[model samples]
Target: MISLNSITRNLDLHAQGNWLPIVVSLVLFLYALFMPKKELSWRDLYITFGIIGYFAWISDSVLGKMLDLVDFGNPKITGIGEFLSYSLIPSSLAVIFLNYLKKTNKWILTILFIIISTLIEWGMRKVGYMKVHGWSFFISIPLYFVVFSFLLPIHRKIIKCRD
Candidate 1:
């Protein structure tokens, strides 16, 4: 019978690194990029994208490097893969989330996005793309919840400033 131990062992043995992060980033970015920007202006999109990317970098640096709560990409070093994954994914997701916020119920969508984000992180860990040292899904869920919950308000603030 295939046990959890066997599966984990196989993963460790086959850890040739995968293209999941880049591919996922590309898909999200493409979808967000090609979609109609009915609710946000070009300036709003640019500002929010930069804000998200900057926030992601700072948060990851503290949590993953300083606090050692997480590890991304290779176990040994930080490189372009880690940087691009951190930068692009969150920025693209923010754009997509903001675009969708217009047509969806904010509360429901926020909760759903949090769940989905947590699952993606969990999958990344399971597939050897990430390692959780001092973190758990519990922490991640709340973090995502707060992040998504704030996104709309932040976007609105940007819009308000633009007017």
Candidate 2:
């Protein structure tokens, strides 16, 4: 019989020291380098980098300290894994919102993003891909929502200005 704990442990073992994010980052960097720069301005790049850095700091320093979500076994190259984990969430959301939903009402998308992202975090916890050593899912969900809310306006402004 496969117990929940056993499943969680296996998932943790599988996820530990994964290199997928690094590879993806390399691909993204290369793609950005080669792509036409007509759409994004220096201000857009600055804002995007700032947002990513802010969220990464929050996730690693603030949230990690509060929730003890740090994966001690996860091998990081110059702390890139930690940064990428947090940055990817907001960056992906920004891309989706800017590319697809700018003209539509944003409230609905905001709610959906919060819900889906929270659920994804919860699922990771359940599967042991994420271990919340000091915090519960209930706490994480609201905290993430708050962060997302704070980031939404910045993302919108940057993307809109660039577009």
Instruction: Report lDDT (CA) for all predictions.
Output: 0.73, 0.54
Report the poorest 10 consecutive residues by lDDT, candidate 2.
72-81
Winner by lDDT: 1
Q: Which stretches of candidate 2 lie over 4 Å from their true place?
A: 1-46, 65-83, 101-104, 158-163
Off by over 4 Å in 1: 1-17
By summed lDDT, the worst window of 10 consecutive residues in model 1 runs over 9-18
Clash count per candidate? 0, 0
State the lDDT of candidate 2 residue by residue for 63-151, as single tens digits.
56655555533433224444455566545444444333443555676677778666655554554445456666677667656655556
- Candidate 1 per-residue lDDT, tens place, 41-126, comes to 67777877888899898998898888998877655565544666688888887777776774457888787788767766766777
Model 1 reaches what TM-score against the true structure?
0.82
> What is the Cα-based lDDT of residue 94 in candidate 2?
47
Best by TM-score: 1
